[model samples]
Target: MQAIGLIETRGLTPALEALDAMCKAANVRMAGFKRVGSGLITVIVEGDVAAVTAAVDAGIAAYPKTGGQLVSSNVIPRPHADLARMLL
Candidate 1:
């Protein structure tokens, strides 16, 4: 099953750095990302739920413990696979 995870981080450098490490650890294929006009970085990563979760975890953990903007994440089906099995 494949999932597209979107992580919205506070800053660019830390977010990108954490993303790099998480990507390395999770072994998920990155589908590229871009900074929207609203200063949000859209991280599009494709992999299993565990992989995406780990990546998102690493991202949140990578942020400094204090004085940072809010960090959030969301997951969606990749839409190119078995929806039933993927849901499981």
Candidate 2:
């Protein structure tokens, strides 16, 4: 429960698809999301280290199916506690 996974995409559809894939691929929960302006969106999930890794991978892999390009994917293995407060 110390990891935070993020998948950033160019559109809302891709972001939503990635979010769904992430939750289905691992023991993770949707922490929140951010609309970074100019059509960019980032989806965040929280879980254990391994779970977050798997979730992020699944999210990235689903980008093609979503028909939207992936901007980036990241897993913060030991995110600061203060960051958690800002997520949701």
Query: Best-fitting candidate, measured by TM-score?
Result: 2
State in Å the error of residue 16, model 1.
0.7
TM-score of 2: 0.93
For candidate 2, the lDDT comes to 0.90
Q: In model 1, which regions exceed 4 Å deviation?
A: 65-67, 78-88
Candidate 2 lDDT tens digits, 6-88: 99899999999999999999999999899999999999999899999999999888779877889998899888878877775
What TM-score would every model get versus the actual structure? 0.69, 0.93
- Of candidate 2, the 10-residue stretch with the lowest lDDT total is 79-88
Q: Give the root-mean-square deviation of each candidate in angstroms.
A: 5.2, 1.1
- Backbone clashes in model 2: 0
Lowest-sum lDDT 10-residue window in model 1: 79-88
Report every candidate's CA lDDT. Answer: 0.67, 0.90
Q: What is the lDDT of residue 88 in candidate 1?
A: 33
- Specify the highest-lDDT model's number: 2
Error of 1 at 40 (Å): 1.6
> Compared with the true structure, what per-residue lDDT tens digits does model 1 show for residues 1-88?
4677667666676567667866876867776576765666666677898888787677666656534564677767555566534433
